[model samples]
Target: MPYHEMDALHYVGPGWAVDDGFAAKVAAIVSSPGWVFDSFGYPQVRELLWEHADTVVWLDYSRSVIMPRVLRRSLRRTLLREPVFGGNRETLAGWFRRDHPAWWAWSQHAARRAAIHRLVHDPRFAHLRVIRFGAPEEADTWLYDLIHR
Candidate 1:
């Protein structure tokens, strides 16, 4: 779902058949070959995506590293009034909200890391090839090598 739709959903709440439709969209995407996702994280679609995915690239960065980057990105987007997902722009007030990416990143860092770690080791997902990068440099190097290869 787009950020605007998600924002609207936060206000209107669920039970609108949006999630069901999103699941169908996810299913369709995963059924195809050679697709990529910035994230396939929503609980409604995670299972299907994970089950079909052959590889997982996990970025396990420290909160100190993550919080600053999120804050900077959010601030830049908010200040410039840049249209983000689905033409939604970040607002300064939204920055304070618990659901804001910056806040959410900081607050959920540990829990999210732990959760991903559990998923990485879970027997159900053992077929997946998981490549975990603890720093930006590591990820960049991997991408560089991948591209050069």
Candidate 2:
């Protein structure tokens, strides 16, 4: 999305200390036109973003799908010392340490996916157009259609 547009994008995590600052930064950018905030994670902020976003693309993939992907990504990052959000890096020590976000997300995968399902189906989100993709191929096709249209 950023490649197609030079809009300010804010990524919100489950951490309030991180998300609060991020939300503030987003608010500042949104004051101007043509800026888009693309956040990942954080069901707590769903309503806030839903109100502003005309579209919501959900990759409602299974835990089996997401877990392996997250595991591989984390391991690769940890091994490569790749810089992630805010100049921080992932580490194997962090993954096994039990306090990492990846661990938390993996632990609460079922509950989190359920909550997202509820929120998206609830009448409160009726104003938002949701596109749910069950498979990676379908997701890519749908995204392609949207972009092309």
By lDDT, who's the top model here? 1
lDDT of each: 0.74, 0.64
Assess candidate 1 and give its TM-score to the true structure: 0.84
lDDT of 1 by residue, 33-134 (tens): 766666637766666767988998898889888888988999999999976654477898887788799878888888888878888889999999999999
Task: Name model 2 segments beyond 4 Å from true.
Answer: 1-20, 29-40, 147-149
lDDT of 2 by residue, 32-137 (tens): 4443444443454456666666677777788778888888888889989986664567766787767575787688778867877887888877987887888888
Candidate 2: how many backbone clashes?
Answer: 0
> Number of clashing residue pairs in every model?
0, 0
- TM-score of every model versus the real structure: 0.84, 0.75
lDDT of 1 at 96: 77
Please state every model's RMSD to the true fold in angstroms: 4.8, 4.5
Clashing pairs in 1: none
